[model samples]
Target chain A: MTINEIQDQIIEEFAQFGDWMERYEYLIDLGRSLGPFDERHKTPEYLIEGCQSKVWLYPSFEEGIITFTADSDALITRGIVALLVRVFSGRTPAEIVDARIYFIEKIGLRENLSPTRSNGLLAMMKQMRLYALAYKTKQEHS
Target chain B: MKLAKSIEEIRSDFPILSTKAYGKPLVYLDNGATTQKPLQVIKLLEELYRTTNANVHRGVHYLSDMVSERYEAARETVRAFINAGAREEIIFTAGTTASINAVAFSFGERYVREGDEIVISGMEHHANIVPWQMLCERKKAKLKVIPFSDAGVLDLEAYRSLLSERTRIVAVTHVSNVLGTINPVKEIVAEAHRHGIPVLIDGAQGIQHGMVDVTDFDCDFYVFSGHKVYGPNGIGVLYGKAEVLNELPPYQGGGDMVANVTFEKTTYNVLPFKFEAGTTNFTGAIGLAAALDYISLLGREAVTEREQALLARATTGLSAIEGLRIYGTAPQKVSLISFLPGAIHQYDAGMILDKMGIAVRTGTHCAQPLMGRYGITGNIRASIAFYNTEDEVDALVKGVRKVTEMFA
Candidate 1:
């Protein structure tokens, strides 16, 4: 599915919840179900900066596609990472670089993306885009 | 003063206490970040801007003269509030950060030298830490840290040992913003003074919680922000001994800070005016004085008593929760509580609590070194004011229980 399609699906899923508690519960569940992150990739080199909570995001480029694995100490932020990774991973560099994200606002998680919030979801998104851009640039050069 | 108002009446004074978040009544426990302003302060600000708006100490107009008098009166109010020796000692700056920066730069220029040492405690907020570090880097001085124990008590023995003949100045916080530990500032001051070294007490967290007398403490410098003490923002007080302040160079050079100015040379103004550069925050100073007046009417002792009760209740209730661990168990603490709810992440708990109409501060609370000591990145802090009630404390405890259950 396209990025917009996935975002629409997320918004629809969030719309089923009546209150913030219910929505956050779903996110927490999603956070708990994320794939295991490698311990070696938990170093400072893979750590996303500017977050009050620690988030380590590791990206790998292979066969013209880039895959991302991430983890956060905070469950809500981890849930956010889980969502982003699900949407962006297993996609080519060009797709990720060109993807437009609009679900966070629709799902009422726009605060996590605010510059004032120390959750670093915004930073994580930016880092993901930067990685995709770098891969795209390198591929074109080669 | 008048008989202290009941908590209900006092809560009424602050309009924000009535505010709701996410369709629930707000439980504001983030007083450490900044206290909510009372109608007394808010109305005073509005009244000043509406009727008495003027540039102080510069114009010959009626408004300017009136405002200048009120501004100086505000300084007198601050002096009386902190019980400083003289009104000339209160230098108004932007906030506590600015006040500390002013001292660091001016004091560094005047006193700090190559290979000199500046001692600070581990529990200091970033506002107190970074300024000295900048000063050290500029002067090639060394920054010495006094370590604290698991209970968040500063080791005065270590502090005494750290102070040497080459120690330039000792700076420490009167209260830890994150840990809520009230340091023994009087003894700390005496210890530094015994070594003939001056001490700078960061009173940003201390001033609001209890009475602070610079004369009684005998500290050379004490600093605080207005907004944290139920006053206006953009205004803070740096109370310095006249003898010590006079020896230091001015931090900034601008309009009101000079006695005489020429292209060739300019002499600085006297005492407080020498430190206050450019057009001062006259309006904010006036509002801060009004806030002080409001607190006086409420009665400081009563406020402290009520807040202590809230703190005790919170501690007891939160301690009862299984798997919950509270940090900063120093016997002497203020109303604030920082904790980790079992294996639940602080951000996760804070987010859940925020959605439940509880406003808590989550993160390092700008005391990274203290966090490092505890071996945790951050925790959830719920700092209370006198306006906060037992019901709010109960709500917070209940909220944390819910967070742990949800995560479980």
Candidate 2:
């Protein structure tokens, strides 16, 4: 599916829930499914800067597809980054970079998230895009 | 002394107390950051803009005279509130940060020299620490720190050893924002004075919880923000001793602060005005006076007692929570509580609590050095004011329990 199609699916899943509790539950469940991050990749170099909570995102490319894994100290922020990793991983550098992720706003996450958490989510996405950009440049040079 | 109104009555005077935060009534426990203004202060602010609006200290017109009088009258109110020696000692600035910056520059210019030392405590807010650090860096002087104990109280023996002939000034917080430890500032002042050094008390957190009489504290200077004590932002008070202030050079020179100006040289204005550069926040001054009036009418002793009861309840209730470590355990402390619950991170717990409509501050509380001293990144801080109630305390305890379970 396209990036928009995947985001639309997320919006539909969120629409089935009525209140904040259900949305949070869904996010926490998503975070739990992300499994344990490699202890070596949890260093300061992999950490996303400008985040209110501690978040680490590690990216690697294989067979022309970029894969990402992430973790956060805050439960809500962890869950939000987990969602980003789920949607962006296993995609080509161009696809990950060009894809527009509107699911956050469409699912009312933009308005519902606190100012601090919202900034963290945006920072997490920016870090992922940066990784994709680096891969895209590296492939062109080769 | 009789309170003009009860706790419920005072709570009613603050309209924000009635506002809901996520479909639940907002429980504001972040008084240490800033206070919610009462309706009296809010109405006074509106009345000033509506009825009396003009530039102060310059105009010959009626509106100017009216505002000028009110602005200076607000200075008098602040003087009376802190029991400052004279109105000339109270210099108004943007807020606590500006006030401290002014003192740091002026004092450094007059006293701090190469090899000079300025001592500050570990629990000082960044407002108190950064200014001295800048001053020290500029003057080639040294900034010395007085570390605190595990229980969050400063060691006076360490403070005494730190003070010496080369010490210029000793700056410390009257109350710790993160740990909620109320230091023995009076004793600290005396110790510094014995070494022929001066002291400045950061009263940003101290002014509201109890009486802050400068004469009794007897420090060389006392500073606090208006917003922390129910006033509007962009206004703060710097209460320096008259002789000490007269000696230090002016902070910023502009229209109001200058007495004479020439291309070659200029003469500065007298005390208070010498420090107040440019046009001041006249409306903010008036609003601050109204807030002081609100507290006065409520009666200080009565308000302190009521707040004490609420604090005691909260401390006891939260102590019952298993694995909840309350950071500051000083017996002399009051009102505020900062804690780390179990293995739960402060951010996750704060998020869960917010969904339930309970408001609390979670982070380093701007005392990062103190956090480092305690070997933690941050924790949750719930600071109370007199307007808060036992019911709200109960809600906080219950909310904390739920948040811990949710994260677990």
Candidate 3:
């Protein structure tokens, strides 16, 4: 699926929640159910330091498509990362780089996505895009 | 149990208390970061900007004279609030961080030499830690730390050993911003004085909790921010000993800091003016006076008692939560609690609480060394003021329990 389609799907899923508590509970569940990340990828190279939480994002490009995996200490942050990974992963570097993410706002998680929130979501988003841009540059060079 | 005024009256004074957050009544417990200003302080700031808007100390006009008089009077007000010797000792700066930097630069230039030592406590905020660290780096001096226990009590024995003839100065917090430990600052001051070392007490957390008599403590410097003490932001006090401050050179060379400036040489101003270089925060200073007056009318002793009760109530309520670990279990503490609910991340807990219209601080609280000591990234801090009530404490406790259950 395209990034926007997946984002719309996620928004639709979140719209089912009755309240902030329910939304958070679903997020926590998502966090708990995240696929096991490679332990070796958890290093300073992949670390994104947020004032409130720590996030680690690792990306791999293969056959013109990029896959992303990330983790955070905070459950809610982990859930948010899970959402980003879902939307951006399994897409071409060009597609990932050019995609505009509006799911966070639609899901009423805009507060958490603020740069000043320092939960690493905004930083993670920027880092993800940077990774895609680098890979795209490398692809162009080849 | 008698208060100067009822909690209802005190809450009414702060207009923000009635405000809502996320459709819920705002339960603000971030007083350690900064207190909500009373209507008097807010109104005074507005009035100053409206009518008394003029540059202090230099203007020859009527507005300037009026503002200058009020600004000087504010200095007197601050001097009396901390029970300092005279108004000359009280120098206003941007805030606590700026005040500490001024001391670090000026004091380090005069007293510190190569291979000297400066002492600070482990739990000091970055404001207290970084300035001294910079001073130490510049002078090629060593920075010694006084460690605290698991209970967050400062080890004075270690502090005593840390001081020596090579020790240029000792800087410590009167109260730990994160730990809420009210260190025995009087004893700390005495110990530093025994070795002829001047002490600077970071009173950012201390001055708001209770009465701070600088002469009684006999510390060479007492620094605090106006915003933290229910006053306006962008203004802070650096209360130095008149004799000690007289010896140190000015931190900055600007308009007000010098008596006369020539292309050849510049003669510096005396005492407080020497430290205050540029156009000072006169409006903030006046607003701070209003805040101090508000506190005075409320009565310091009364505020202390009321806060103590709130702290007790909060401590009791928070202690009951399963698997919640409260850091800084000091016997002597102010109305603040830093804790982690079970294994939950502080950010997650804080975010959830914030959604419930409860404001709290969830980070290192600018005490990374202390966080290092605790072996954690950060924790959630709910710091209370007198305006906070048992209902608010109960709400926090309920919120924590809810967070814990959901995480489970």
Candidate 4:
């Protein structure tokens, strides 16, 4: 499926929520469902600094698709990154680079993200695509 | 309770309270960060642009005189607001950061020397900490911190021992932004004075919570931000005693701050103007006066009663929750309550609260050292104001409970 289609599906799923409480409960559930990040890879190199909470994102290129791994100690931030990961993971480098990730705002959740964490979300997306761009360059050369 | 009754009516003067966030009523508890401007201040901003718009101090034009009159009048309002000794003592700057930076630069140059020590408390916003750090580095001086108790009160004994002939100036916050602990600035000032060292009180969070009588408080300098006090963002007050201000060299040299400018030799302008420098935010200054007037009408005692009552409500409600630890347990606090719920990251709770239309501050509250001292990275701070109601406090307590529940 296209990135836009996946994002659209997520937005539609979010729109079903009647209120913020239920929506956050859903996000928290999604966060808990994320398998524990391998501790070895949770190094300073993968960490995104300046977030209101600590976030670690690890990425690798496999079969020309970007495989992104991420975690945050804070559940809400973990949930927020989960939203990003769902949108961008398993995509080809070129596809990841071009995806707008507008589903956050489209679902009205972007407005609800606290100012500092919102920055962290943007940083998380930016890093994912940067990884994608690097993989795209590697594929182009090799 | 009487104050709360009147405050419900007072809340209407602020237009944002009537607005909604998502589907819920906006529960604004971030007044420590910035205040919602009253309609009086907002209208004054509009009126200034509509009618009283001109460059101040330079032009002999009628509009200039009128603009200058209002700008100076605003300075007088600030002077009265903080009970500053003289009109000349109140220097306008961009905000509390600017106000502190001016003193740090000018005062540091004049007094701070190599091997000299500048003492600040553990609980200071970066605004108070960074500028002094800069000055210390530039002057090859040492920076010292006065420790605070676990309950968030400054250790007065530690402070007394820290003072010495090497101590040039003592800078401390009158209130902790994170803990909401109101320090004994009067006592701090007295100690600094005893050592013949000058004290600068960072009143950025101080003035809004209660009456500040600079004459009685007798600090060498007092500083506060305008936005935190329901005024415009671009304006702040730096209240220095006339003699102390005269001792420090002018902070920035520019058009208005100079009496005469010759390439070879230039003389600076007088007291307040000497610090003002370039084109000031005259509109912001007018709005600040209007905000002060709004506060004055409500009366400081009433505001205090309402804010304290709300804090008590919030503290009680949140304490009922299991595994919640509040920071800054000083006997005298105002306007703010910050806590860390068990096993929940402050960001987790804060984001959930935001989603529910309950605005609270998360993270370090700009007091990183204090956070480090407490062995935590951040906290959820829900600071109330006179405009806030007990119902909103309940919303916060309920929201926090839900946050813990979802995370658990």
**Candidate No. with top lDDT:** 3
Tens digit per residue, CA lDDT, model 2, A1-142: 8777777888899999999878887877786777679989989889864324778888889888898888887777778887787789888899988988788887766743455554366777888888899999999999
> Which candidate number has the best TM-score?
3
Tens-digit lDDT track for model 4 on B1-408?
A: 245336657887898997787777899999999999998999889989999899999899999999999999999998988888799999988989999999999999998899999999999999999999999999999999999999999999999999999999999999999989999999999999999999999999998998898999999999988999999998998999999998889978887999988889999889889999899999999899999888888877888887898899999999999999999889999879989889898877887787788999988888899899989988889989999888899999998898888888
Candidate 3 Cα outliers beyond 4 Å, as residue runs: none
Evaluate candidate 4 and give its CAPRI docking class based on DockQ: medium
Top candidate (DockQ) = 3
TM-score of chain A of 2: 0.90
TM-scores for the candidates:
0.98, 0.97, 0.99, 0.94
Error of 4 at B388 (Å): 1.2
Error of 4 at A138 (Å): 2.5
What are the per-residue Cα lDDT tens digits for candidate 2 across B142-241?
9999988888889989999999888999999999998888899999998898888999999999999888889988999999999999999989889999
List ranges where model 4 is wrong by over 4 Å.
A1-16, A62-65, A98-102, A112-119, B1-5
- lDDT of candidate 4 over A27-76, digit per residue (tens): 88887887678899888899886548777999877888887888988776
Q: Model 3, residue B257: what's the lDDT?
A: 90
TM-score of chain B of each: 0.99, 0.98, 0.98, 0.98
